[model samples]
Target: MRLRDHVVVVTGASGGIGRATAEAFAREGCAVVLAARREEALEATARECGKHRGARTLVVPTDTTDAEAVEHLARRAVEEFGGIHVWVNNAAVNAFGRFEDVPLEDFRRVLDVNVMGYVHGARAALRVMREQGRGTLIDVSSVVGAVTQPYSHPYGMSKHAVQALGSSLRQQLYVEGVKGIHVCTVMPATIDTPHFQNAANFTGRKVVAMPPVYSPERVARAVVKLVRHPRREVVVGPAGRALVRQSRTAPAVAERVMARQTEKTHLSRKEEAPATHGAVHVPIAGEGSVHGGWGGRRRTGMRRAAVAAALAGAAVAAGRRTGRGAPGC
Candidate 1:
């Protein structure tokens, strides 16, 4: 469970949870391999990892949606690090729009990265881990995996599939007598990451917003726990935790309430000019730029973030209680 000296491979390491988790593991003395589609970003994240002395780091630019590329990522990790002990499947994308409005290509893309990305990572890591006799596959799922969301059906579907696959894989490992290898899922609510901003906005509404968002470091801290002691699943943030609890205790009521709340909300309306579907904007809000200030200034950032997180958590809880979503800001 000690990460010191362990070899860890993190997908989607360019930013958000991946970057934070990579740095966190590095600080614990783990040899880290950071992977992402952007070579520059991956390299930069690896450099951050290097700041933690004694922890060697490598940058492998990879497109998780591609099976061949993912295979290369695994081979490179083993070739360089000797072996892989922990593989964090954290790469994903989202498109915000009604099912009818979202393009089929977008749906396929989301599934490929979110669902198949985990499949590929788990397959590659499981092979190495099974041979090593001990390893862990940590998946970064979302709160939507367990609940419903408006204007983000594609993302929600992909995450739900991930949750299902994670559970099935865990059982498969048990059945195969793979004792040391563990498959776990991290289901979090809206964390303050670039994911939401990068989310394709086709909802015909501008100004994307969420009531509350948890800091990426909170998620990083949770991943650290999984590295130390793997669990079947862990929900981040109070809202996320409460929703999971509510889902279990009142599945019908929860679904009905969530359905109603989503119906009342509007998603992103950002549109690209004709012939250009690609966007250069930061994928999500608070991405790239650090919130609050530098170094220890996280204190101020955390204070503000805590309030938002509380509001988000309360909103979800209140929605469940009242079966209605409050008006958007």
Candidate 2:
């Protein structure tokens, strides 16, 4: 689809994939509406968007957890721009801890933003889209949504909910014969984002992005592609695709490898971290960006990630060889 003059709304525009996606739409000459809790960070994103020729952005400071605020965000986008051609429900938060150890409030907070935030955005955007007779709703889910992870209990659950949200919405739209409204989900693997550093960490160990971390721009490219040709779901990175495929074919091996990975590489073994609610209840101001800069010996780390990936691959290969997962390859 030609998207040069499309109007796009992107939540969580303060940083990470959301910021990258917003900038991408701006580059496409789309009127981008930036929404997040941090006004300063939103302004920063707006400035970056404005750098592109024909890029116009509106900074709407919105806490996606707030239903009313999200509604206002959609209205603002419609008011400033002509209409909402695409809405990116990308706002999210994470809490790192065992299912029981993590505080109940933090868990709920994660759901409020990650799941319910999409609910609000979908409702508001769909209302406008139904009226306009065309629009796209993009939900940013995770690879963990397809394959579960340890310690990030709430995060995994919330992403699973996001995946469900998109599916259910699409089915309902079909039932209602809503021809022009489209709901799509984007599942990205670990990327170079600040989510790891800002998560509510209670594991007493520093959280890391592990390895095989692609740049946020990679995910941005995926989102932009979706705008051109909407799909039911899109997995961004090769590792993410492998994990999803492994989980489907060799479920047992996928679970074992994922548990081992989250237990080992996902958290720092030597560095001690204090228990704190990182960004669950508050926003990190003046420090938001597209990249997290949480780098280790990435080449070595990726070698380790490659090993884990090979394990998953080997399991699938073994399953095919043994005729366990399927009749044949």
Q: Model 2: per-residue lDDT, tens digit, 227-319? A: 788999999877889999999999999999999999989999999899989889899868489989854235436767888999999999887
User: Each model's C-alpha lDDT?
Assistant: 0.77, 0.90
Worst 10-residue stretch by lDDT in candidate 2? Answer: 294-303
Q: Candidate 2, clashing residue pairs?
A: none
- State the local distance difference test value for candidate 2: 0.90
| lDDT (tens digit, per residue) of candidate 1 on 235-278 | 98776788778888998877876666555433433533222123
- What's the distance in Å from true for residue 213, model 2? 0.5
TM-score of 1: 0.82
For all candidates, what are the clash counts? 6, 0
Query: Model 1: which ten-residue window has the lowest total lDDT?
Result: 273-282
Residue-level lDDT for 192 in candidate 2: 85
TM-score of each: 0.82, 0.89
Misplaced by over 4 Å in model 1 are: 207-209, 256-329
Query: Which candidate has the top score in lDDT?
Result: 2
